[model samples]
Target: MPPATLSRTEQSYLLDGLRSKPAERADRRDLHEYRMMQVDTDLSLQADGSARVVLGSTEVHCGVKAEIESYDAPHVNVSTDLEFAPWLPPSPRVQVMVEYSPALLHEHNATELAMITDTVQDMLQACYALTGNSIGPLDARQFIVVPYARYWVLHLDVYVMSWSGGNVLDAVFAAAFCAMYQARIPGTKILALDKAAARQDDEVDQDDPAGIKFITRGRKPSSSAALDDAVDFALENEWDHGRLLAGREDVPVCISIYPFEDTYLLDPTLEEETALSSSIAVLASARGHIYGIRQRGSGELTLDAIHKAADVGASYAKQLAQTLQARFV
Candidate 1:
């Protein structure tokens, strides 16, 4: 006689067993522990800055290239693209392309594709908002070489190289942070404004060869001792751009929590994700301030669950920020 196959209900029961008393997962990791992650910075010599991140089986790459443009307002342009390996089995893919111009929005039709695009755009915007309206090290105000005349335009490109399981948002954010941490901008010096020339006339001298300067975004030190230490560190390690950027206390990180029955799982794998009833993605700073919260899935979360998830997410974000500082700085 042929062996009997388990029904859908039976299969679900078995999977639930992995999450019940005396729970056992293939990786043997605790429910709260995230998967192994590896972050490599400055991977591209051609780009201004670049990083590659591997979280569990997922891999993401980010590159930043900057140019000086004549504009009244400074802006940071972000774009994302995704490509799957041909050998892999067919699966759903999300692609987001953001342009600075408003004309690109009309190209999207009112279909599933449009929804995916909109979702991706919202996520990116949340990331930017969490980091103080800037995706890279320097904000628009700092990028301006000449007020209302010349400023730096940064183009951040992110690509999903591989996807196996786990949260892609965490991986993408990590890669982006690393890339920005390694970025350096050209040195600029102000010149006297020419009263007779047009306002659009170039006010910055591009031929200066004094050398590039590393851009830093953070609050000034509160004490003289801290300021002295920072200056000493900078003078001793002038070549270390990544360290300076990574040391910023205001840098934010993301945490994703999924609700599984009565329990909540952190950095859930593909199997756990499929079994999840609802999920929340939290973007928090190192100091545990919740900057962004996004919910998904068919099930609803109670008020208590939302608060618990936020607390858990904040703790995880703090830990992640510390780890990145230790590794990169």
Candidate 2:
């Protein structure tokens, strides 16, 4: 049988709604309201950290694993892989591998794949910057037991279970943030390295749970009090099943804005996404600073539209950040 296609009437209706104001959309959400979101963290025992995020009908799962590796620098390594369900349509399946040296560099095949990789890379960099380049509260030195020798390396993997359209970047960023929030690196104590002996001897302690110090950012009591209350409510209702993540105060959330004629809509649906003339994504810190911005889709964006979209995205980012913070708390 031939593949099914949208009927002309259906297509026309969707296009008309996309061009209309947000209130006219079938969901009746305001121009600034986002679709419903559900987030769960620490769902995988085998991984150092893991999270599953569902935004409207789109679902994504992210897992983070870490290990100690000999390195010359003190930077976190990030790798991202995006996989669609086997039943989904045929599109590019790509993986982005990045190693942070003196500069950031990535390896991928195909121009299209390269673009995807660059987009994801930019998002990850923004996330790291939003956290002040610290894993939790500890500085880069803390991540290294032996400077210029051995340090921690983190691997992040993300899988898309469903694509209902809209901005997948928002979902990806949320999942990555949740996974990183829940990630824990095992603690270690380094012994002195002996080089004068006939045989060099280096010893390190690696198997003591009591010595295991969790990577965490110190929480600010002023803002954390509200988060704590929210957490209590979530726990009571069983909405959050994972342990509270450390250093959550610095995490950020992203929001994507789709532009119709003169209106910028927040969290467009699949139909709206298809009809969008242009789009922009913004990554905002928990404190409301714009950390990163990217233009998306094939449409051109005016300078005014960019400014407007950033402002709108900031609002949504704040809301989403608070919501995710409460979940992680």
Best by TM-score: 1
Runs of candidate 1 with Cα error greater than 4 angstroms are 1-14, 72-118, 129-140, 196-249
lDDT of 2 by residue, 1-329 (tens): 00123576876786676566444777887776777778888789788778988888767778877655553322232232211111111211112233212111232224534465466665665454313334432233334444234455567677655545445678877887777776666554444332311022233233321112211211122321121211100111221343233455555677888876766677777666756556788888566777778887778888998998888888878877777777755
- Residue pairs with backbone overlap in model 1: none
The list of candidate 2 runs beyond 4 A from truth reads 1-11, 18-22, 72-118, 129-138, 193-248
Model 1 Cα lDDT, one tens digit per residue, 1-329: 00124467855864776667766666877777788898888788776778888888767787777566654322222232211111111111111232222332343233533454356456755554313323322342445454334555556677766545557667776776666656666555554332312132323334321111111111122221111211100121223332233233545677888866667777766556656557888877677877778787788889888888889888888888777767656
At residue 2, candidate 2 shows an lDDT of 8
Q: Model-by-model lDDT, in order? A: 0.55, 0.56
Best by lDDT: 2
* C-alpha TM-scores of all predictions: 0.66, 0.65
Worst 10 residues of 2 by lDDT: 84-93
